[model samples]
Target: MNTLSPTTAAQAPPSRWALASLSLSMLLPSLDTSIANAGLPALAGTFEASFAQVQWIVLAYLLSITTLLVSAGRLGDLMGRRRLLLCGISLFTLASLLCGLAPSLGWLIAARALQGLGAAIMLALTLALVGETVPKARIGSAMGLLGSLSAIGTTLGPALGGVLLVASGWQAIFLVSVPLGLLNSWLAWRYLPADGPFAKGKPRGFDLPGSLVLALTLGAYALAMTQGHWVLLLLAAAGAGLFVWRQGRVAVPLVRLQLLGDRQLSAGLAMSLLVSTVIMSTLVVGPFYLARGLGLDALAVGLVLAAGPAVAALSGVPAGRLVDRWGTRRMTQAGLLGMALGGTLLALLPSASAVPGYLMPMLLLTASYALFQAANNTSIMAGIDPQQRGVVAGLLSLSRNLGLISGAACMGALFAFATAADVSIASAPALAQGLHASFAVATVLIILALLISHFALGKRGQSGTPD
Candidate 1:
C-alpha cells in the first residue's frame, strides 16, 4: 500500500456527523472491555467455574487485543483505515452476538477473543483517521473528545452492566453492542474518506513472521503473569529479541524500530503505559475494596467508582485547549503530579470509609489521566509523520493494553501474596492491607512516570507540532 507524503495538503475537517460516528465506534470497544466485569459473578455462577477460570473471560480479550494491536495498525496503514474499520465493526458486532448467545464459559471466552481482534483493528485506525481528517490546529481537541468518550464508556460500563443484568441478564451486556456496532459501521461507510496511496509502488506484504513473534512475546508474558510460570518469561524475552531483530531486517517491519528514538514519542508511550497501569489497577481493585471491605452493593460501588472517569470526561475538552495553548509538557506534568497525589491519597486513606475517601482520590486520579491522555496523545501523534500515524497509533494502543494486563495481573498477585493467610477467605482487613500495598506501588510508579516525562518530554510550555 502507498501513502501520501507527510507534507501533502490537509484533508477537509471531518463533519460533526463523521466525528460522532468515530467517537461512537471508539466507545463500543472501550465499554466492552470493562462491562463484563460487572457480570463476572453471574457468569461464574452460570458456568460453575472457578475464579481463575472466569478471569479468562476478560484476560482472553485483553491478551488477544494486546498481542495484535501493532500488526492491526500496520494492516490499516496498508489496506485503508475506513475499510479496516468497517471490517472491525462487522466482526466485533458478530462476535458480540456470539458472546451473548454463548451457552458455555469456554464459548464466551472464545467469542471474546474474536471481539478483541476486531477491537484491535478499530482502535488502531480510529486515531490515525481522526488525525488525518481533522485540521492540525484542532487535533488536540479532537483527541481530547475521543479520549473523553472512551473513558466515559469504560467508566460507565459497570453501571450500565448492572442495569442490563438486573433488567435481562449478563447476556444483555454483550447483546447491547450489536445494534451500536451496526449503526457505527453504516455511519462510517457513508462518511469516512477512502484510503491514501502507499509510500512504495508495490505493496510490501504483511510481515507475518514478525507479527507471529510479536504475538508470541506478549502471549508468553501474559501467560506467565496469569499462570505463575517463570519459563514463559524466558520465552517472552526470546520472542522480544527475535521481534526486534526482525524489525531491523525486514523490508516491511511490523514497527519501525527507529520510531523509539524520538524522545517525545518514546516518552509519551512510556507515560501512557505507566499511567494506564495505575488507572487499570485502581479500576480492578477499587471495586473489590468497596464491595467487599466496605460492604457496598454493586450499584453503590458503581456510583462511587464512576467519579474518576466522569471527572476525566468533563475535563477532556478543556485539557485539550490547555494542550493547545500551554503545551503538552506542562499539561502532562501537572497531570502526572495529580496522579501521584491521588495515588498517595489512596495509599493513606482508611479503606473502611467508602464515600469522600474513596471518591475524592479517584476523581483526582481520573481527571489527571484525562489531561495526560489528551496532551500526551497529541504530543505523540504530532511527533510522528502522517504516513506513519497508523503504526504509532497501534504502538500507543499496545502500551495501554499491556499496562492494563500488567496492572490486573500484578495487582492481583500482590493482593494475594500480601494476604496469604486469608487468601481463600479474603477477610476485609486482609483485603484492605492488600489494597494499601497496591496503591503504594501505584504511587511510586506515578512518580517514576513523572520523572520520565520531565526528562524525556523536554521543557514545559513547548507546544507539540501539529499533524
Candidate 2:
C-alpha cells in the first residue's frame, strides 16, 4: 500500500497505458447500465416474471451503485485508489459471472446489485485517478476523452446487447463483461500508479458510522423513488440529517462539508444532476416511443437511440479543447441551450415518421451532454484540492447518479400516469401522447437548468467563480 503525499505532483506526463486501462475499466459499468434494458423481455421470459418484476434487474443495479458511490470514493481516499480499482474490477467480473449463471430472477437481481457495488467503486475513482495521473494543462482533454468513452459505452450498450440477445441469450449480456473486466484488471495492475501508504496519523481509517448513514440515506431515497413509498422517503430524510450531523463531528469525515461552500463546484454538481436527469429521461422515453409507439424492432430502436451518444462521442475531444480555450461557463451554457432546443424538438415530433424527428433531437441532446460533461467536470475537479479529490469526485459521480435515478423515476411516473388507461397494453396513439408529455417535461427541465447555469455558473472567461 504505497501512498503519495497530498502535496506531491506528477513529475512527468501520464502513461498512455494507464489512461487506456482507466478508460477500459470505465466501459464495463457504463455499458452495463444501459445494456440490461435491451434484454428485459428475455429476462422476463426466462424467469417467468412480469415486466415490473424484471425491472428490478435494472433498478437493483442502479440503487446499489448510487447508494455506494460516495462511500466508495471516500474509502478510495483513505485506502488506495489503485488498490480499490483492481478490487472493483475483480468484484465486477465475479458478479458478472454470477449474473450470467443466475438461477432465478431474484438471483439475477442480487447479482446485479453486487455488480453495481463494483461499478460504484470504479465510477467513484475513475475521474479522481485520472486527475491525479494527468497534467493540469491537459486535465480537460483527459476528462473529455474519458467522458467520450463513457458516452460511447452507454450508447453502444443497447445495440450490442440486442445483437448478443439475438445471437446467444440474455445471459450473454452479463457474460460479456467477464473477459473485458479481466483484461482491464490486468491493465490496471500493470499501469496504474500506487498510493504509497496511508498517511501517518490520519483518523484511524474511514468513518464507518458516517458511511453507513450516508448509504442508508441514499438507499432509502432510491427505494422511495423506485417503489413510490412514503415511508422510505421519511427514512431517507432522517438518515440524511444524521449523516450531516455525523460529518460535522467526525474526524476525517466521509465528506468535508466545507467543499460545498465552493460556489463553482456546487453549481457544477447541480448542473451535472440536471444534465444527467435530462439524458436518462430521454433515453428511457425515447426507446419506449420508438419500440412501442412506432412499432420498431429492438435493432432499429437501438440504432435510433445510438445516434445521440454517437454524436456526443464524435464531438467530445473537440468539446474538451473548446473548454480549455473558451472556459467551462461558455461551453456549459451553450450545451444547456442545445439541450433545451433538443427537448423542444422532441416534444413537437409527430406520431408518424418519428424516427427522423427523434434522431435530430437526440443528436442535439447528446452533443450537449458531451460539451457539458467535460467542461463541468473540469470546472468541478479544478476547484478542489488534491487531498480531497476522491471525495469530491464521489460527490460529482453522486450528482450524476442521483440525477439519473430521479430522472428515470420522474419520467417513468409521468409516462405511466399519462397512459394509465392503457398501462398494460398501450396503443401507438396512447404511447405517442405519453412520450410527447414526457418530452415537454424534459424541455421544461432544460429551461430550468439553463436558468440555474446562468445564475450559478460564472460568465465567459470567468469559469473559476460562480455568478
Candidate 3:
C-alpha cells in the first residue's frame, strides 16, 4: 500500500500551536471519563431512576469507546485522519449538547454513547497526528505534554464536576464540554495540517464483520469486568474466538493478525496493561486506606487522592524530556524501577507513618508512571510503520482502558480478601493490612513489567533497539 512517510524533525516540526490543539483533543475525552461519574447521583435523582439504571450513564460512554476505538482508528486510516477528527469533534460537541438537554434517563445514556464514539475518534487520532506532525527526535516531549494534559483532565474531573453539579445541576457536567469541544474543533481545523490525497485504486473497504465481532467481544469483556458475571466472560471468550477466526478469513481484517507477531509491539502492549493495572490500584485501593486506615473524612480522602494525579500532571513534560535525553529503553526501565520502589515502600510502611507515608509512595508511583508512559509510547510510535499508526495508537489506548477495568476488579477483590471482612465494616487495622497486601501485589506486577521490558527491549543503548 502506498502512503506518505511519517512526519519527522527533518521535515520541520509542527508549530507549538498545532501541538496545543492536539493536546486539547486528548484532554476532552479523559475529562469526560470521570466528570460524569461525579454526577451519577444527581442524574439518578433528576431522572428518578434506580442506581443500576443510572449507572448506564457512565457505562454507555465506556462501552462505546472500548468497542469502537480500533474501528475509529482504522476509519481514520482509510477516510483521512484530519477529516475524521473534525467530524469527531463536531459529533462530540453536538452529543454533549444533547446530553445536557436530555429529558429522560434513556436519552442521556444514548447521548453519552454518542459522545463516546466521538471521544474514541479524538483519542485515537490525536496520537496518530503526533506521528504525522512531530519530529521523531522530539516525539517524547509531545507525548509527555499530551499525557500530562490527559492526567490533569482525569484528575480535575471529579472536583470540577462536583462544583458544577452543585452550582448548576447535573446538566452542567455534560454542558461544560460543549464550549471546550467547539474551541477544540476550531483550533484543530485552523492549526492541524491538511491530509495528503489518498493513493488511487479501488478504495480499501472497512472490515464490517471483524469490527462487529470485536465490538461485541470487547463489550462483553467490559461488562464481565464491571458487573462480575461469569456468563458474560464466557460470551466474551466465545466472541474473541469468533473474531480471530473471522479475521483470518476476511479479505480486509480490522486488525492484521501478523502485526501481533512483532515482539516489540506485543511487549509494549503487555507492559502498558501491567503498568496501567498497577497505577489503577492507587485509585481503587487508596480511598479505603485514607478513609479507614488513616481515619480521614471524605474531604480529606479526596485531597489525599488528588496528590497522585497532581504529581503525574507536574512530571509529565519533564519526564518526556528525560526520555528524549536518556533514551526510551533506559527511561522505561528507570520508571519501572521507581514504581517498584514506591510500591514496596507503600507495602512496608506502617499506617503510623500517616498521610506523609501514603503520599510519598503515591507521588513517586504517579511521577514514574508519567515517565514510563511517555517513554513507552515514544518507543512504540517511533518505530511503527506510518500506515498503521492510527490502529496502533488505538490499541495502546485500549490496553490502558482494559488495565483500568482489570485493576478495579482484581485489586478491589484482593483488598476485600485481605481484609477478610465486609469492606464497609472493616477496622483500621484490617484496612491497613489490605493496603499492605494490595501494594505487595502491585509491586509484583511492576517487577513483571520490568522483566518484560528488559527481555523484549534488550540491553540496547540510547536507541530502543533489541540486540
Candidate 4:
C-alpha cells in the first residue's frame, strides 16, 4: 500500500514504463466515455429500452465519476496512490465484464456506475502520480503526453465502438476494456513506485461526512444538468452550501478550504473549467451545424467532427514541449488567445464555405486546447506539495468535468434558443444562425478566461513563484 515516493526518487527522471502506465489510465476513462456513447443505439435495441432509459448507461458513469473524484484523490493521499490505482483498474475491469454480461438495462447502468467509480480513482491519481514519477523539468512533457493519449482515446472510441458493435454487438464495447484493464493493472503494479512501510504516526482520518455530502451534491447537480430539472438544481445548490459549511468546521476535511487561496491552483482550476466549457461547444453545436447548416450527411458530419479531437491528439506532445520551453504562464496565455482567435473565426465564417471553413477554426481551437491543458496542469501540479497532490489533481479533474457538464447543458440550450426552432428540422439559415451565436458566446468565454489568466498568473509572476 505504498503511496508517496521518497523525495529523491520523486525528483529523479521518470521511467518511460511508469509514464505509459499513467497515460493508459487517462485513456481508459475517456475511451469508455466515447465508446459507450457510440453504442447507445445498440444498447437500446438490445434491452428494448427507451432513449431516456438507455441514457442512464452514460449518465450513471458520469455521475459516479463527478461525485467521487475528489474523495478518491483525498483517500489516495491518506492511504496509498499506487495501491488504490491497482484496485481501481481491477474494479473497472470487473465492472466492464459485468456491463458486457448484463441481462437488462438496469444491470448495465449499474455496472457503468461502478466502472465510473473506478475511473474516478484512476483519473484522480494519474495526475497526482505525475509529480512523483517525472522530474520537475519535464512535467509539461509528461502532462502533454497524458493529454494527448486522452484525446487519442476519445478520437478513436467512436470509430472503434462502431466496428465492435457491428461485428460483435453492444456487449463488445464494454467487453473491450477487460484486456486493457488487465494490462494496465499489471503495468501499474509492476512499474509504479512502491510505497514504503507505513510511517509511524497517528494515521490520517477520513472525512466520511464530507465525502458523503459532496457526493450527494455532485450527484444532484449532474442529474439536474442532464435531466434539466430545476428542483434537482436547487437541491444541489443547498447541498453545496452545506458541504462548504461542513468542510470549514471539520478538522480533517476532505478538501482544505485554504487551498483555494493558492492563486496558481485556483486560477488553473477556473481556467480549465472555462476552457473546457468552450471546448464542449464543438461537440454540442458542431454536429447540428454540419448536418443542417452545411447539408452534410451523417457519415460526412462524423468525419468532419472527428477532425477536432484528431488535431488535439496530434498536437498534445508538441504543445507540452512548447509549454516547457516558453514557460507555463506564457504558453497558457498563448493557448487562450489562439483559441479565442479560432472561436472568432468560427463565429465570423460563413456557412457557405462549408467544411473547410468549419475545419480551419476547429483545428486551431483543438490544437490550442492541447497547449492550454498541458501548460495549465503543469503550472498547478508543479507547485503542489506531495501530500496534497491527489486532492489537487482531483479538483482539477472535477473542475473540467463540471465545465463539460455545464457546457453540454447550457451551450446546447443556447444553440436551441438561437435556432428558435427544433434543431432536427431547422432550416439551413436557422442552423447557421445557431452556429454563429454559439461560437460568438464561446469566443466571449475564452476572452473571459484570458482575463482571469492574465490577472492570476501575473500575480504569480509578481510573487516569483517557481514552476
Across 39-60, the per-residue lDDT of candidate 4 in tens digits comes to 8888888889888999899889
Tens digits of per-residue lDDT, candidate 2, 1-467, equal: 11234544453234688888888877789999989999999888888899999999998898888888888888888787889888999999999999999999899999999999999999888888876676565667777888988888887888799899999998899999999999999988887777666657755468888988898899999889878898999999999999989889987788888888777778788888888888888777877778888888988986777777788888888888877777778887888888889888878788765678778777888888888888888877765676677788889999998898789788888987876655447888888888778888888887887887788764533552211
Error of 1 at 411 (Å): 3.0
On residues 1-467, what C-alpha lDDT tens digit does candidate 1 reach at each position?
A: 11233543344334676687789878999999889998999999999998889999988888888888888888887887788889998999999999999999999999999999999888888887776566567767888898998888887887799899999999998999999999998888877766666657745678999999999999999888767888998999999999999999999787888889988888888989998888888877777778877888978987777777788988988888778877778888888999999989888888556578878888889888888898888888765776677789999988887787778788777767765545446878887787888889999999999999878866734765333
Over 1-467, each residue of candidate 3 has an lDDT whose tens digit, in order, gives 11235452334335587798898899999999999989988888888999999999999999999998899988888888889999999999999999999999999999999999999999988888886666566788898999999999999999899999999999999999999999989888887777767768724889998899889999999999999998999999999999999888888788888888877789889999999999889998899888888889999998899989998998999998888788888999999999999999999979789999989988999999999999988888776777777888888899999999889989999999998988788998999999999999999999999999988876543663222
Q: Any runs in candidate 3 off by more than 4 Å, and if so which?
A: 1-14, 200-203, 459-461, 464-467
Global CA lDDT computed for model 3: 0.88
Clashes of each: 7, 7, 1, 1
lDDT of each: 0.83, 0.82, 0.88, 0.89
Clashing pairs in 3: 9-135
Q: Top lDDT: which candidate number?
A: 4
Query: Candidate 1, residue 391: CA error in Å?
Result: 1.2
Given candidate 2, what's the lDDT at residue 59? 87
Q: Tell me each candidate's TM-score.
A: 0.89, 0.88, 0.96, 0.96
Badly placed stretches (over 4 Å) of model 2 are: 1-14, 40-53, 103-107, 166-171, 291-299, 348-354, 416-437, 459-467
Q: How many clashing residue pairs are found in candidate 1?
A: 7
| Candidate 4 deviant stretches above 4 angstroms | 1-14, 197-203, 459-465
Which runs in model 1 stand beyond 4 Å of their true positions?
1-13, 40-54, 103-106, 200-203, 291-299, 350-354, 415-436, 464-467
